[model samples]
Target: MRSKRIVILTEGHTNPITAKTAWAVLRYRGGDVVALFDTTQAGKTAGELMNVGGDIPIIGSLDEVAEPDALLIGIAPMGGKLPTEWKSIIVSAIERGMTIISGLHDFLSNDKDLVAAAEQHGVELVDIRKNNERDVSNRLDLREDCLRIHTVGHDCSIGKMVTSVELTNELKRQGQDAKFVATGQTGIMIEGDGCPVDCVVSDFVNGSIEKQILANQHHDILVIEGQASLAHPRYSAVTAGLLHGCLPHGMILVFEAGRKTVSGMPHIPLTPLPKLIQAYENLAALHMPSKVIGLAMNGRLLTPEQAEDERKRVQDETGLVVCDVFRDGSEPLAAAVMNLRAEIFGTPVAS
Candidate 1:
């Protein structure tokens, strides 16, 4: 999948928040992304819109791109439903012999028109969110030698996946045997394989994530991507399941610096960072002892000064290393994880 020449369809929504799939793929797998299809933002490079995806052109239509191997749905909205207006674009891509890839909860395989069109064109429709695993959690013991680091969030879509990926990459850069265990659609896409834990049945959520952890336990470190916040009104169940499933040794708390309300739910105010930190720690303590080792701030909405100030405030209040992994790089957060690992397991940090 990483080798395929892919064009992302972001259409009208092409910002970092809305078009996170496009942004993340470009950030981690830019070589595979040939172009992005966003008519509203056509004629501009993705780098021009977001700070990532250097020089990748944004095309208005499929005809503007030449011989792409796949078309990825690049936006993940609240309900994860496919926009009605994008059907024609997807059909057109299928007609042109490009495989369709989606992460929406509304499965493309269930759509009659898409299925018929794909059959006619002899192209595949890959739904990253589709899961068939029926395994239930058995409280299986995990590998003692491997260190599991999980990312927990204050609200949904606050950069847990980004923080996990960046930390894993940084650990690898430092010569540690680290593996990223992806738990969501974006992370799965970036890693090429992972269970969309959020999509699995409630009974199988823990088992689903445990399967991935066990599979990757050969590595010395497992940086697991997280899902919705435990404080989230609608999606907290998945968070609790993940917390119990992975049983992380340490966690990095992620939050958008100035975000006060739950995303897409303005009426529900976001839980404070300290309370969220406590809640996650308390929840994890039920199954295994785990601590919040650090904080990863999503400061995209804040200016440089404001971001820095918030980082300091968070650090001062929480007494943990705080970093915006994208802006400050993952070295500090990685170092914190390594320190925690060394403290808990007496593991030697690589020079």
Candidate 2:
């Protein structure tokens, strides 16, 4: 994939977090962001709104923007229905020769009008979450030949995917053959591969993960992107399926540092890090043995001093490596993963 110049369409959406598609592209692939199309947030910059990417202009519509390689619809609305208003914009982008990249479960490619428009204009529509409803027939045979790490989180959108992507990038920097297995729509869009576990039926959820891991058997380290929280009542089934399917040898528990309660389920308070990791490890034990190497703390909301203090506190309490995957990078976590490889497989990270 060559460097893509893209504009994100978060039109009619408000919250930045639920704007999952936009946030992932901005946080992980900020360099590609040429502009943001959000009528409500028009005229502002992504820096002012999201506070990460620096001053990417926010436009009122696709008409206001120039040519872009892609137009990304990054909103994952509940029920996954494409808004009627966005439909015209999709057609307009296609007519202008920009490929449409959407992460919605309601695949834009399936829309007859959108399809015709793209074909007429010689553009493409890339739908990440489409065709995930098929059954994965492979038997559940968890592999142990390579080093595997699953990024579990305290809640949905708690930086699990970010941890996996960042760790994979960090390991590759050290010249290791690390493969990232994306497990959700955002991860799929980022990697251009992997499954959306939530879109699969409960019966095939584990199979979905198994298929991804088995395909990457040649890699030295398989950093699988995890989804949801074991503590989240609503989506824990998906989480459990991922754990059983991948059967990771070690774990990196992801969390937003200093969070008081789990997102969405505010009634259920955040679990203590040690207990949470214990629960995750116990679940992982049901399939194959695993241990948590460290914490991938999302310290974006914390002050630098507060983040350092919290990182020190977490390490002191848990006796495991803790790193701000964004700020601190994944060096400590990568080193811990290598150490785990030696402990479990009696080998270094492929030398």
Candidate 3:
């Protein structure tokens, strides 16, 4: 498939958390992103704003973009609803013959005005969060020959998807036939194929993820992109579904350094790393024996020295291989995953 010259619509919120869709797209698909539309951050480069997309122009309006092929709704706000204020911008882009790509729970295809405009311009409205899978969990056995590694997080947006992607890439770099099974909209966008398990029906979440696992069992390893944390108060169901569904042989625990509370909910204290690890392992053991093989720390908020210190401290405390996958690299974590594969299969991965 040909890459589209895309422009992201992040408007007022261009920070890393709120504009995470933009950040992931920039991090993984920066080559295709022509510009970012953030009025407040206009005239600044994406690198200056979020330190990812190097020198990608941040423009104030669609007019600033020169015949871009698509406009991605680059913010997944709370409730995943489309912002009413951005309706005009979306309509304008559709009129200009740009495909509209959205990852929000609110489907742009259902919006009458946007649909009309897209039809008039002969463009597509791609809602990445839309799910069509209806299969229930068959509880069928997964391939024992293929190792499945799932990324479980301590909190939401703590870098589970990033860690999974990096690990998949690193495993492939080491000559393992690895595949990343994306379970969220951002991951689906980046991988170009995945079931947005979070959007699936409550009863179908397991089936949805199991479907992904079954399809990708051909690979030597599957790095499944995780959703909310198992410790999350509100969103733990999705995490539970992922755990039971994937039945991973090994897991990577992702946590942000110095995070004391649940993300976005300050009143709730976070579960300790040891307890969280135990919780994940216990839950996974219900279906199959799985242990967290390593830790991926999100140290974006910390200085390099602090991050290194935290890595050493966490490793010493948990007795697991630790890495800030983004700050450092996926080498340590990838090696840990490969080691788990070797231990389980009693064979070394071919290079």
Candidate 4:
């Protein structure tokens, strides 16, 4: 039978017993072990791991251990003291889908992004600071922890727009006060290197748009949208910005269906006038909201006809002012923001 791969890490010599004990448990379970010894302690710590069956595959550095199945990082006082390079090491693990068991103090201070990324992938975060002193076995079952996420949308989808409107109307039908956020061409995607793509560009534009939205900050829920390609390079930038900005408090990722392949998945096309508005409404609901009221629309679609429909729908459903970019005669996006009630900011398209 093939053995499972398990990785163990210790801060310094004080926790050699803890390190050896943790390693022994895994080895007893028929698992292969790779241990990373933090030798930051004058050289005494490095000598200890070598002392006890010491020839264990000692990783001189965190970078040395690129990939591991499960990582047991001991947050010793000495071990917790780290250089910046350690940040990348943990991020790389999260990217590769590793189960990381870390203490609360270790997680909150050192690897915050790693913790978020891990939670994003549904990894369990164990706070061992207080529980480490207790029997690991007895405390494993008590996983009562508070984790909350404030997700915000910076893109749009067709169905999402309609859904936002529908949701708003439904809320009003229930006699609840509602608020929403809507803007034109407010989506972006920024690359790891700061380049722009469809979703990325949309996200970038929306970052500023979000700031503008925050100025008003009157909505209970917010959603944004994009067209054709959902995983367009731009999507990454926008997603990162929204996650970092922590606005709107929810998110909805929208892509066109039957239009193009994004990240190897079929997306719904965001063309036509009406569905574009619907997409805007739908993307509005992707994040958690305040007051838990209704929904709003945000995206770069909405033609003149779509804008008219959206405005009418906004009036009927939300009973609040609604607007679109299509009637503005701006760069044609299958919809113009021109209308008697709405304002346009760019050059008019020659019909």
RMSD (Cα, Å) for all candidates, in order, is 1.3, 2.7, 1.2, 21.9
Between prediction 2 and prediction 4, which has the larger lDDT? 2
- Candidate number achieving the greatest lDDT relative to the actual structure: 1
TM-scores for all predictions: 0.97, 0.89, 0.97, 0.26
Question: What do the candidate models score in CA lDDT, each in turn?
Answer: 0.91, 0.83, 0.90, 0.36
For candidate 3, write residues 50-137 as lDDT tens digits. Answer: 7899899999888887779899999988789998989998988888888889999999988999888888899899999887778888
Consecutive 10-residue window with the lowest summed lDDT within model 1: 136-145
After superposing candidate 4 on the true structure, give the runs of residues whose Cα lies further than 4 Å from its correct spot. Answer: 1-3, 11-32, 37-50, 61-67, 75-88, 103-112, 119-123, 128-351
Give residue 148's error in model 3 in angstroms.
0.2
Error of 2 at 222 (Å): 0.6
TM-score of 3: 0.97
Per-residue lDDT over 187-227 for candidate 2, one digit per residue giving the tens place of the 0 to 100 score? 87778789888878888888778888888868879999988
Per residue, candidate 4 scores C-alpha lDDT tens digits across 1-351 of 121454555544324334433432332332355554454532342335433334345554545554566655543232234335555655555666666554323343345776688778766543333211111111122111111112122233333333333333343343433322222111110000111112223324434434434433343323332222222343444444433333332232222222233332346322433343344334434543321122233323445566566556744654433333212311121111122102222333432
Candidate 4 similarity to native, TM-score? 0.26
**Residue-wise lDDT of candidate 1 within 48-163, one digit each (tens)?**
88678988999998888778999999999888999999999999999999989999999999999999999999999999999997987676667797899999999898899999
Clashing pairs in 1: none
